[model samples]
Target chain A: MAKKLALIASKGTLDWAYPPFILASTAAALDYEVCIFFTFYGLTLLKKDISDLKVSPLGNPAMPMPVPMPNFVQMLPGMESMATMMMKQQIADKGVASIEDLRRACLESGVKLIACQMTVDLFDFKRSDFIEGIEIGGAATFFEFAGNSDVSLFI
Target chain B: MDFDKEVDAKNLNCPLPILRCKKGLNDLQANQVLKIMATDPGSVKDFEAFCKQTGHTLLQLDQTDKVFTFYIKKRNDAL
Candidate 1:
């Protein structure tokens, strides 16, 4: 009896891009139908370059302080790598599955994974760059699908 | 029991654990139970809201120290 949920994913990194999938998965777990639309940096999720996804530290003033240094300074050296490791480990430690694992589960669970057509064009990405089974559509189409959803999240 | 599937999501942050649990339950029958073990504090609120908004039954909720457990029985046929 669960209502549907639309999760909009916009981030690039595994750390920043997990919310949409997480929310959609949970909604589906609750027996609600789920849909996820990946736009902008969120498209990186379906790419093979998943490991290269990282938060841009330069303009991000709120990046968590590593030690006593300012966030700007923390962006130096291997900070991105450190952050990625920490985030990945945290997700794993929490007993949550990996992005790839979750992605597979989602496919099997009937979660609709959509790639934003505008974003694909904006980034000049070839269709081959994305995963094989995703549906490519515009915002209007996505919204149409999401119209009756009881819950919607922009992650 | 063979009737239930468990998803351990303890110590996880918002969304992923919940997402994993969701995927785990999606394939279950209407009366099947999906047990979720989570440690994120947000889960308490997130799952509550999820059930309310989705119309699923949040059959039981248990929390201890860093562990949070949820028992959700699918009821799509009743929808």
Candidate 2:
């Protein structure tokens, strides 16, 4: 009776990335057979250069910070990197753990990591760009696996 | 009777109790039972869903006013 869990991860931002990882990790911990499908922007999570993935500060006026800062200041060249670093540090400080940690936990707990084949082809990325132990597949593959699952989520 | 492992998850919500229960289960040997004590009303449904999805056996559920307890046996320890 072990049901499969399919998580559709489609965003690259720190906020967005955490949800899929956290949920999948938690599900796996519960001994639920879980798989995460990384597509489009979400594919950035597996890149060797994780520092490059960023959350856009544009349009959203409510991005929280310890101190009040102008939108223009946040848009500066190095600000995105700074923000990512700060977010990483904050997560660690709060004992919330990192996405890397969650990924490791998920893998250790038998959670499957899948990269979307269509998205990879769309983005023109090679398999070498992904981390080790990740399986590559398409929508049909995921649907076939996920169709019988009791719980399926899009994060 | 086998002694069941207990986890107190007071005031935790959504995924926290379930997360802790999972971690606790992982620490045990196969077929060992874990009893989770939770105040979250959602835990009943959540743990039920968890057992259905994970293939674990949910042996019992006890509710007394504000507290809820679940007895779950770890089934995937071999993995």
Candidate 3:
């Protein structure tokens, strides 16, 4: 039997969005049956249009900056947007696939995408807000799949 | 080395190359080999791990002028 991978995605920063999609696609390529449970802020990643995703430098001192930046500088208005654009440029230059591409790959490779039902309601998201082919479920649904997974991760 | 098919994953990073390699392998019959070319710096280890997990064989990995070339033989049992 193929191995199974269960991932819980709880964060939704532009930087944080890559992991669940990347791991799920690669695991699918490796013939593993994979599923991702997106909750809280992570549900934002499944939105039909994700152009607004932004990476913030605030409180994330480890984020690379072209020039040394103080915490106050990072907190300035528009800094988060600037940082996000710059990081997107860097990712493009590095030939990294965009989050949309990776997510598409995950779906094409048969990785199951599940959105937390409570989170959807909490965030006031309609089912139509998400892209096609996703199921909505709660924690128990996550455990049902995770219980049989060979690898389970919370990202 | 000889191969039945070739996939160009050039200028793509990390999992793109790996995913392309998987797709290439999927199209071939058992024992057929797929050749992949990638420009990702991490392709060497990435392909190795991919082959390891998927039961494919990495026949050769070569690098010349930053272009990485790998030859992978599909697993005997692969569909």
Candidate 4:
């Protein structure tokens, strides 16, 4: 039997969203049965329209700035958008696949996606608001999958 | 090294090369070799780990300048 991989995506920032999707897709490519549990802010990525995903630069010290800026300076009104643009530009310049492309790849490669039912209710999100192929489940379901996985990650 | 199929993953970075190689390998019969050429600096370690995890055989790995070439034979029992 193929080894299993379980990933927990708990953040929604543009930068925070990449790791789980990237790793899950790569693990699936390696023939592992992969599953990703999206919870809290991470549920935003599974929304039908992800264009609203933003980067919170105000408190994110790790947000890469083209020009070094202090945390206080990064808190300026327009800094979040500016930082988001810079990050997107850098990702494109590096030829890395876009989030949309990665999502598609993950789906095509058979990486299972699960959205937290508790979060969906907390956020008042309708089932139709999520992209296709998502399973709605809570902690028990995630624990069941994680317990059976050979690799488990929280990203 | 000889291979049944060739995949050009040059100029692609990180997971793209591995993703492309995986897609290419899917079409190959068991024990058939798939060759991948990539320019990503990370591909050497990536392919090694990929083979180890997927149960494929890494037949050859050669590098020239910025290009990295890998030959992988599909595992007969791997899904």
Deviation from native of the Cα of residue B36 in model 4, angstroms:
1.0
For candidate 4, give the docking quality class from DockQ.
medium
Tens-place lDDT per residue, model 2, A1-155, is 66578888988887787888888877776656898888888998877666555665555577777777788888789877777778777665544656676677777777888899888999999989988888999898788778878789887
CA shift at B13, candidate 4, in angstroms? 1.8
Docking class of 2: acceptable
Best by TM-score: 3
Indicate the TM-score of model 4: 0.93
How does residue B72 of candidate 1 score in lDDT?
84
A1-155 per-residue lDDT for model 4 (tens digits) = 88999999999888888899899889889888999999999999898887656776677677556677888887778878877887788888887877887888999998989999999999999999999998999999999989999999998
Task: List where candidate 4 sits over 4 angstroms from the true fold.
Answer: none
What are the per-residue Cα lDDT tens digits for candidate 1 across B34-58? Answer: 8988888888898888777655678
Tell me the TM-score of each prediction against the true structure.
Answer: 0.71, 0.70, 0.96, 0.93
lDDT of 2 by residue, B1-79 (tens): 2546888876665566787788878777888899888888888999999887677889889899988988899886445
Query: For candidate 3, lDDT tens digit of each residue in A11-34?
Result: 999999998999999999999999
Angstrom error at residue B1, model 4: 3.2
- Listed per prediction, chain B TM-scores read 0.86, 0.90, 0.96, 0.96
